[model samples]
Target: MYKKIRFLTILIFALIITAVLSTGFIYSISITNAPSKNSTSIVKDKGSENKAVNTKIKKLDSNSYNILVMGDSLARGTGDESNRGFANDFSSLWRAKAKKPIKVINIAVNGDVSSGLLNIVKDQQNLQYIQDSNMIFISIGGNEIKNFRSTDASSSVVQPNNEKAVQNSYLKNLENIFKLIRSKNQNSIVAFIGLYNPFGDDLTADKLELLNEWNYKTEDLVSSYDNAVYIPTYDLFKYNSQNYLAADNFHPNSAGYEAISKRIFESLKNFKN
Candidate 1:
């Protein structure tokens, strides 16, 4: 009877050891099958890394285009917000799509006339920029006409006969302007921003006719050069003059500048290689 009891006690101890081993094996299997929080975190981090790499590549691709702007108050961004003018917008637009870097040289001044610009371009420093530029923007003749009309009458009404001398002078100066730019860089694309009527409904019939004549003359001048183009801005503010004009009712507002930039950007498509 004592021997039988000893054998039974040994069997009970063996069963206890087997139960502990079985429980440990089950726990190990559960851990091996489940997804870990750390693994998910690693995947998210890799996705972010890929996005950063793509952005870097885009920046690298956009570093080679150059632009030059020569005009009056409009090019200087007098009434636009932050003075980030059309030149700036044009460069940014090109960079975004062309994926290439761009350089902008805007030498436009407020109240500048075409004659004054002709003299400015004669300077060696300015000539260097003209030669280096791939594109050139010009906005003139407005100050020439407006300043001339203002001296004779305080009224915004522009008469055809009133601007005869100024108009003649403007056409000559503009011709010289194109000649000067082409002399430096024959390959640079030139874009002339035509004058817009700021008087809205208050504009006189004579003034409208004068503006149309000026635009036509400028377009004719631009046609003389292979690389030059004329961009008309008269209709943009014709009916919506008040909304697009700044507080002075002369310069374009921020929204108006944006519209001009969009037009310029559209023209750029023609020159793309």
Candidate 2:
């Protein structure tokens, strides 16, 4: 009886996956169809020009594959006014570049950080949708610090003044996530985008210092992962804060997010091998 029940459960799970995976299919098609240049954000003066940067999936022998990109508001495409966000732009570029289709499943929420991401992935529904991904991208850790800062006595900039200590715990969360992904798909490649400074002149110099410090540490932690590539956005956004940040002063705008996608695309485009 137990065996029969388990079989029925598996059958039901299969049906649900088939029903909900259409969006992912359409989403992949959208990415493959976008212009490669469409993902860049360039600024120019006189003869100078500036542009920003810009994934995939399929079967063992297929021409295409699926990639799952997960993270916080950055991944949600918050900074851009167009609301199309960098994720879509990146996918569009993939469509334009790859001989085969590349589907991207983006699971980034507005305020997700490390723990938040862990919490979300633990949920069976969301995890189910991401299982077959050919690769995964994570841009977490921005929202985690706010928890301690909200009522704490420390007027510290990024978090508890001792960020290295906090990162130790955060790294564990990253490890667990990768483990889960491996369990679901042994062949999947993973990349984690490092954090960037949201604070500019608006922040107290001390706060800015802390922000940079954290961004640096984020890249460090990301590097230690075997299956991960750390894509840096701190400088991309920091070089000019006002222009990069959204109206809210925290996230990146269309141009800013576009720059991030470019960085990510450059970092992992070699995954086809």
Candidate 3:
């Protein structure tokens, strides 16, 4: 009878261990999957910061629509061998899904910043494109944080103060950007692409926290616009960064871009409906 009881105890312990592990695994998935929908905020109070309420711009008056792509190397397809980044893939899918002809004007430079994007939008010709576009995609701010590293070259730790400063500057530039674009084209739907750390498994817990903070602020800003949306790529690339990254280990490769495109397209579809 003692042996029988001992065997039952071991079985119960094993079952408990399995249940705990299963719960943990499920919890991890929930955390990872939740960000995609959570990143998009449809609020309309961005005017407090810029004093310009996002005007509800009309959709393209014609069957054909323009899509203006702006921002850094990620926008320019730096890591993809085919040179067609996520935006390009997204454009193709969007054209097919929307059944509308799309004129894609991707002027994103390989090393552009939010300030650079502001300048580009400030240009008369680019402003014309903005004015004509039905949609715009801005992918910036990652460089602001990615360019800075910890005091130790080998460490992934980001100083809190530095991160704060970077985020502040990024948010300011983004505000100005929104103002400029809205000033030119009140009807264009602006989609701000959130950041994804390419460091993946190499990224420390502290660094990941900072990245999340960046994403949260980005979503907040995007939500403030009546005609804006935030597309979260952090979770998309979080677990697959190493495999999705290009040879340079910074930008997303073809597979990575495809994944990002699908997510952005999903958001666009929902927003349109």
Candidate 4:
């Protein structure tokens, strides 16, 4: 009876040991498979860090200016010897006076017409620029007028019917351009550079009249928008045609662009008030 009791005690002890060992093994496996507290914290911290970086990259300061320049050869600064078109010059002038940060995105195409510019602005990249910009400058309509002048040498004659059709089409394109710009960015200040008569020296009376009419209509359109302004180049080049005109006799030279830059800078002053 003593031996049997001793054997029973031994058996029970072995069973308890086995149970404890099994439990310890299971716990070890669980610890090995589960994610560590430190690792989880690291992952969350990395995600938050990325979010902060993105936020910083996306937000612009209040004093920052992003300028978007669009339209034709004039916008491209094609005739300027220094290659800094009116847009760049204007940017420099603004930077000097405002002493603030500026970014200029000039997507102006040489010889681009209003219709062409409309197509360009429709592009995704340009739309993104337009959305980001606070100041927008457009130099168009000159190519359209030039095309008309080229085809009809008798434009000097008062052909109201034909001229009316051309004007209508041009105005329609301008309306669409303005609508597209305002759709993407409503609060941005828009400045439309008006057409100048390059043929002033030759006394192209009919061209002058047409340009004046076009500018008048354009200014009217500009007035419709509270934040939009028409920067008239007609008067700038009209009296000083010899000095402002480039060798091409169409686009403005460096000096001419400087004058335009000054005018644009001055015009922006009114907005501050």
- On residues 1-273, what C-alpha lDDT tens digit does candidate 3 reach at each position? 999999999999999999999999999999886757645544545445322334333344466767889999898888898888887898888876556777778889878888888888887667777888888988998777775545464554355666677678889999998988888878778888888888766677777777788889889988998879999988887788877899988889999999988988888886662
How much is 130 displaced in model 2, in angstroms?
3.7
lDDT of 1 by residue, 19-70 (tens): 9999999999999988896763323355485544443311111346668788
- Give the Å shift of residue 89 in candidate 4: 0.7
Q: Where is the poorest 10-residue window by lDDT in model 1?
A: 54-63
What candidate 3 gets wrong by more than 4 Å, as runs, is 1-63, 151-159
User: Whole-model lDDT, candidate 2?
Assistant: 0.69
TM-score for candidate 3, residues paired by index? 0.72
- Cα displacement (angstroms), candidate 1, residue 12, comes to 99
Which of the numbered candidates is closest to the native, going by highest lDDT? 4
Lowest lDDT block of 10, candidate 2? 51-60
Question: Model 2, 30-110: lDDT tens per residue?
Answer: 989876874654555565453221111222324466767788887777768888666667767666555567766677888
Where does model 2 exceed 4 Å of error? Answer: 1-64, 146-165, 204-209
Predicted structure 2, TM vs. truth: 0.65
